[model samples]
Target chain A: MRLEKCWFCSSTVYPGHGIQFVRNDAKIFRFCRSKCHKNFKMKRNPRKVKWTKAFRRLHGKDMTQDSTFEFERKRNRPERYDRNVTMETLKAIKKIDKIRVAREARHHKMRMKGKKGIEQKAAERELEQGISLVKAPLALREESSLTLSKIKVKVSQPQAEYQMEE
Target chain B: MAAFVASKWSKVGPPLLDNLRSSRLLEPFGKFQDIASPGWNGLLFQQLRTFIQMRTKLKVVDNSGAKWVRCIQALKGRKGARLGDTIIASVQEAQPRGKVKKGEVVYGVVVRAAMQRGRCDGSEIRFDDNAVVLVNKQGEPIGTRIFGPVPHELRRKKHLKILTLAEHIA
Candidate 1:
């Protein structure tokens, strides 16, 4: 079972251990244990409860909402968490990376546009050096971008050469 | 209280310059969700009353005992909107458009998930004493809070470390 962070307290939660309360409205609340659960139950005033029911009644379950709910429920459920989630999350995270990359690319392109060839060459060199020092993973471990099996072959190449010499 | 609870339209106060002639032709309808105050309950109840009144097509929707309706009403028009046609239409017209401006509003992903499950987004902003408020990729806001204060032990840890998954594992 995958460990989950308590939605309420950020405590670690193990499967089969926490209290599961499905809001009378179908929303699931998982607690790490009884303490957080007790507090959660105790904190409920008439106002919060009415707000919850009203909101649920307002937004009837539909596909987009269901998927989002599933993503979260699956996020906590280890069985549904796999490469799919990782890929989706990575794709989403890539939006941030793309923004930075595009900014630099545009800035560099602008700097080179009006420069003379010789000065542009020097500028390009400076830019390359600057980029080299950025320490981005894509720049640092370019070779490791290969598949795991390819990485295994690369790792074993020196041993193979040594064995052939022997 | 007005700064936080008042809608942007309310802050701008009725338009001084009506570029769009539609404003001149159409009678400026009073905003549907206009009574929000700093008090959490008052804002929620008024909005819910509007939602029910609009949903039922009745001009007046009474709030008998449901206090949560206040927050619920503000929640009516998002994604899978649930309130009646009249309220939903008013909410749509009243909703601020495009991306967030002003100070960013931050919220937690779990809370986001909870709200999405219930089909609402703005509710998470109300009582987040513990959630971290940060900026996200959209340059939009993000915030999260555990339901309570940070435990003393967590105060010394790093950002992600402070948020433990131990309680959510099940």
Candidate 2:
């Protein structure tokens, strides 16, 4: 086999002595070792070095009429889709979403295990300081109020009067 | 692991913040406020240390948040004397060329121009807006006046410009 010229140094490269480097410029270069490749990289001037075959052929300015563009267009095509099947898929998606939400809630609880202590401490401090940490929707406001009343009853003896009357 | 890092930051970081916040040096200069969470004190310390170590190219904004202090060289004595031009001239006249050895106080100022942080917006960043003058012993300005070294490559091209917030300094 005829010897290949080293792309960087232009030296004759034996069969196993070098590897080929192809650049966006469409030039092919062979380097004897990584050291030469590194030195080539260390050169600050961009105009000094030449890149190899694949780089040049792949990167240069877009030539839309190139054969590769036709090949790429043929490889990627829209799938034949049916609208009726999409609605069925959407129904199945809703079921899947319900299950996914349940799983996410479990995962959320697991993640909260470590932070629960911190939250509890904050909650206890808020309670001791007579601060409200209640967060609930308007629909649950009456229920939350009842819950608060029960808590207040348990914490103090004011509810004993009602119980004795009953 | 996140908590550990946060805890370490809290415990180890305050002294540096204290240095930045309590630089009694800044009190007389201008209204330096802390907007940071833990505070500007820690941020200032970290920035100061980074500037001193040459780890960053970013210049420091003085306590007033107006001027940028680049190429900082600090000589210390008293901070009061270097406030006005008279003090700066007197100190320069008293000690001529070379280093003013014993009685010399250090002054630290930014060498390159300072732009108000938000001038592109309406709010201008100023040097003297909130600045403190650090002076040396016997009340002189010799301690610190930022100079773009005469013929040096890195600093020579840069000229010093002070961004005045108000007509405070005469």
Candidate 3:
């Protein structure tokens, strides 16, 4: 059985699963679930939806251009199967899968290389903006200390005045 | 001068009209026009190769207690009924004490046609069995639940109730 991709989310729609919508013009759209179908009915763009593969690809979160992806593409032409070729292809599939995984991991690492520094910078900026919420204001702290000392001097002066009066 | 121009136009106009009528470009639009017309009786269009017969057996896909039904007549057309078309069928088999009794005639909407239907996206779909869901005179389904996959074309045919009751739309 041939596997279909969901029109909305780019997810695999296995046989006997998912819903297919054929428009009046004869265009077919397969949805993996009711959620994708509902989103499609709402006229939401796949690239605009944050959770969809189209969104991730458009936002540079996933590898968009890769030779590895070419292997998974659906080809209309069937190849003549030979015993030796089949064995080689089976061996090649495992090797290709391993290479693809390694490439994908490398791509992800490259994409995330500066993520830590960017996150730290963002945290610093946030702290700079909201530092007063977390800690007392330096100027206010200094002023409060001076005010406390002044209050102590005033209290002492009041005691001296009371003592003089006594 | 006017008479001369009219005579000249007549010679050109008929051939042009004939060419326009015979052209392949307007063929699909003509089918669309038939669909758009309110009085369309499904006579001129033969979308499906095989049509349901008067005595054709249909598997009921709903829980309204009918297991099988035989078509007595297809409504709105003398030829036959395709997917999404409604037919008057007599209950051939049903569960005991069910809402529908055996031998009772009921209206049913065709949910799945065994013949393959071509889509505009260069794909074709065919169901394994010919199935129907019992409905009333008001075009609303009598069954509360549907068991198998139905086509999205039913929705285009304005069978929203069937689409809602369906487990899947293919």
Q: Each candidate's iRMS in angstroms?
A: 30.1, 26.6, 39.4
lDDT of 1 by residue, A19-79 (tens): 5444323345666665555446555432233323333334431122222233335453345
After TM-score superposition, the amount by which residue A165's alpha carbon in candidate 2 deviates from its true location, in angstroms, is 56
lDDT of 1 by residue, B1-170 (tens): 22222222122211111212224222333346667643445333432111222222211111111111111122234433221111111111111332222222221111111111211211111111111212243322222222222222222323342244212211
Assess the local accuracy of residue A123 in candidate 2 as a C-alpha lDDT between 0 and 100.
52
Fnat of candidate 3 is 0.00
Candidate 1, which CAPRI tier?
A: incorrect
For candidate 2, report its TM-score. Answer: 0.17
List model 3 lDDT by residue over B70-120, tens digit each.
Answer: 999999667788778899999999999779999999999988876555554
Docking quality tier of model 3: incorrect
**Candidate 2 RMSD computed on C-alpha atoms after optimal superposition onto the true structure:** 28.9
Which of 2 and 3 is ahead in DockQ? Answer: 2
Which portions of model 1 show Cα errors greater than 4 Å? A44-166, B1-170
Candidate 3 residue spans exceeding 4 A from truth: A138-140, A143-166, B1-170
lDDT (C-alpha) at residue A26 in model 3? 35
TM-score of each: 0.17, 0.17, 0.46
Q: Between 2 and 3, whose TM-score is larger?
A: 3
**Residue lDDT tens for model 2, B15-86:** 233333445324434767887652234333322111121111223222322122222232322322111111
State the displacement of the C-alpha of residue B159, model 3, in Å, after optimal TM-score superposition. 22
